[model samples]
Target: MAKVRSMFREVLLKQGQLSVEDVTTMVMCKPKLLPLKSLTLAKLENMQQAAQDTVRQQEMAEKENGK
Candidate 1:
């Protein structure tokens, strides 16, 4: 499970489809053992940041569209 999660994180990060905050939120929401928590948090943070940037860009586009 950890390996799968790690792979997913890496792929998403590489694709620039997620931000650290998004990853952090996923870590907080997902059920994980104590030992995995810290590492997961770090991974999530990277994804979340990317996700945040994407959101910001989308919002800006929407505002320009006015709808």
Candidate 2:
């Protein structure tokens, strides 16, 4: 017995709308040099201020006790 094959094939396709995207790579630039105090220096100044405030409070307490 011999089998017969079909010459045509079936294909299914769905229509859709085209979409867009931002494919551009990010650009790099030279870093800026700001005239600002460093983070460590700023933190140190804050700590010194806090310590001074505590000392002032302690001195005031001593004065109040003496009165």
Best by lDDT: 2
* Residues 1-67, model 1: lDDT tens digits: 3534443433435454654453444334766556745877989998999999999999999999996
Q: Give the TM-score of candidate 2.
A: 0.51
Clash number for candidate 1: 16
Best by TM-score: 2
Q: What is the TM-score of each candidate against the true structure?
A: 0.37, 0.51
Tens-place lDDT digits, model 2, residues 1-67: 8977779675555776656577999899999998599999999999999999999999999999999
Which segments of candidate 2 are over 4 A away from where they belong? 1-31
Every candidate's lDDT: 0.74, 0.89
lDDT of 1: 0.74
Give the least accurate 10-residue stretch of model 2, judged by summed lDDT: 11-20
Tell me each candidate's RMSD, in Å, in order: 28.4, 15.9
